[model samples]
Target: MERRLIHVITPGDHYSPRTGSAVPTVVHGLSAHAPAGTEPTVLVARGTYPDRYTSADVVEYLPGTEPGRWDRRLDPLRGALGVRRASSRPWAAALHDQDEWPPSVVVLHNAPQAVPLVDTTRHAVVLYAHNELLRTYSPREAALTLGGVTAVVCVSDFLAERTRRRLPPALRDRVAVVRNGVDGTVFRPGRRDASAPLEVTFVGRTIAAKGPDVLLEAVALMDRDDVHVTIVGSSGFSATDPLTPYERRVRAAAEGLRDRVTIRPFLPREAVADQLATTDVVVVPSVWPEPFALTVLEGMAAGAAVVASRIGGIPEAVADGGTLVPPGDPRALADALQVLADSPDRLAAEQDRARRRAAERPWSVVSAELDALLAARLDGQVTA
Candidate 1:
């Protein structure tokens, strides 16, 4: 494998070291560690995070009306692009003004606004799909934006299928699935603390789509007092903003289980891994379809039984490794919790299954897969 420059472009910041969001983490993961003879670089328009795992070369922030998703000023763009953050167009144009060598490949993550970059250089563009198509462009816009793209690498098969349907049939040929993976080394197993109470955790944003509310309801429904629940992550997108209304609602919902439930704010990736390591169960109760929840893989890597929503690409990861319940149903979630509670042996079996599944692929393995896809497309082979 000869060395090649790979560039990842995301509309929002790729954070310095703040590692809660899945997209930035994946970008950082790919950028931080490249296979033999490869160089990776990241470009972002806005990010306050300064301690990135990888060296971020692009950090030109632009002014914006508000923080987080649903900025009404760019509401139309969000409806079409499916990203909360604004475009990094200004910095991107400046970067490619051509004093520097253009990347051989450009990965556009969640920003349809930057699709114009395809014309800036001959670099093979990949529109990395991370969510359903509704948040992205319409069929015609998709065809126009992705006209010169080498491929549209989806985070999961569910998203892949949705993406294919979003474009014209001619453009559909470019769609493919490259499932998200976790860092096995950082999320590896730890000794189970049997002395500690049975710890279960729900890690992700506290948004309505994430279904933290359902998890809290399920926790309150569980009759057993031995369970210790921890909900890690805050409600808003900004790292420094006040608690969001959603977070307040979740807190009010968990009022009954105040003593048993611990609402933990978001921690560093290392700390999140530590939390997953000791946790007996990791719940991802997302009501909306998640393209791929990396936390599920991290939990499985840590030898924890994962309980996630059966929607979207989740089944691709949780299959036979843990449990899945219908989305937005607290009763179903409670029932699944009872299953884990009633049978420690069964939970252990699930954990074993998960650990084995997680071991099948590391972040490096996945990055290599992506690199191979890029190589194929760049070589004019379109059978992705």
Candidate 2:
């Protein structure tokens, strides 16, 4: 019997020093909970986690450009110029130098360009989607690539349904809804302060799509001493880029209650989990169709009541753990928070429910599910 390896080819920082993206976080969880004897190696692009500090884990760093070079917008360029998507070709060749041994399962996280390039004959290729399908690839092109894919594992059923609507109906069955899971040990529910004001939190990439501005407006509308806000993470258009006027507007929006709100860049996972643990309520006011709000689930796991946008896969992911508001509506968000803040009993009840919901999607269980799914799709059969 040959040893089977589970390779995770991602283009972001793994959970070593830090994690700023959802796919990396999910990938870290998958690697952490892989079944026994299933050797997991995360193949991430070079410079994705700059400074080159290696962690004691199953990570294989490959050649890649600087942080901003591998943007999804480059997908069209690769297709037009016949350039391969992933920069890990040299590394892959090195790993397969033996020629006889290949990774049994290759889960490509948000690397659409690697789909067609992957040799599906030797390895079971799982297309792990962390975002929308049409955003990077066209319907016909995406459907065509489905021929080589084993399973289109979407983070939420919402993403699965959205992708199915774009692809051929026959390929719909290949779509699977494996909702994102959290490390239960790291993100368990904690005691909340009953006397303190309702503490609200929003954590993600500090972009306009995440709706930090909308959350600010909703907090301003509350106009109460009892409402607190904390928005963490960064977006594009950094200090060097003059093209970002939206960030300027975001700074201006905080002028009204600067003292009441704490808006900072991304923090370490422990710091984030700590914030979620102490928080009374966590808000996800995404203006765009979010594939899945991992922050919402993490907040729920921390026993905090979550208030999020009802669009995309959030409603499905959230289930009964949180209250769903219309996307981009500050007034609706304000109303929901105010109602919860005034009623501690209701807040506590939701917290209990949220914790229970999170327990159902622990990383160990989710990882086992993924391992089973990928193993069954293998071209070569095996028995323990």
Quote the positional error of residue 299 for candidate 2 in Å.
0.2
Q: Candidate 1 clashing pairs?
A: 3-37, 16-49, 16-51, 16-52, 17-51, 17-52, 80-136, 82-135
Instruction: Report the poorest 10 consecutive residues by lDDT, candidate 2.
Output: 51-60
- Evaluate all candidate structures by whole-model CA lDDT and list the values in order: 0.73, 0.72
Encode model 2's per-residue lDDT on 247-360: one tens digit a residue.
567767877786778776668777788888898888999988888888887888888888999988888779978899999999999999999989988988888888888888
For 1-384, candidate 1 gives per-residue lDDT tens digits of: 553444554444555555577777777667655666666656555444556665334534452333334443564565366443244344354245323554456667765555665553545567777767435457766666667777788888888887777788889888888888878878978887776667889988878999988988898889678788998887644446688888888888777786778887777788889888888999999998888888889999998988999998998877677788999999999998888777888878888989988887677778888878777767743211
Question: Candidate 2: where is the Cα deviation over 4 Å?
Answer: 1-5, 15-17, 46-61, 64-100, 135-140, 236-244, 379-384
Model 1 accuracy (lDDT, Cα): 0.73
For each candidate, how many residue pairs have backbone atoms clashing (under 3 Å)?
A: 8, 0
Query: Measured by C-alpha RMSD in angstroms, how accurate is candidate 1?
Result: 4.1
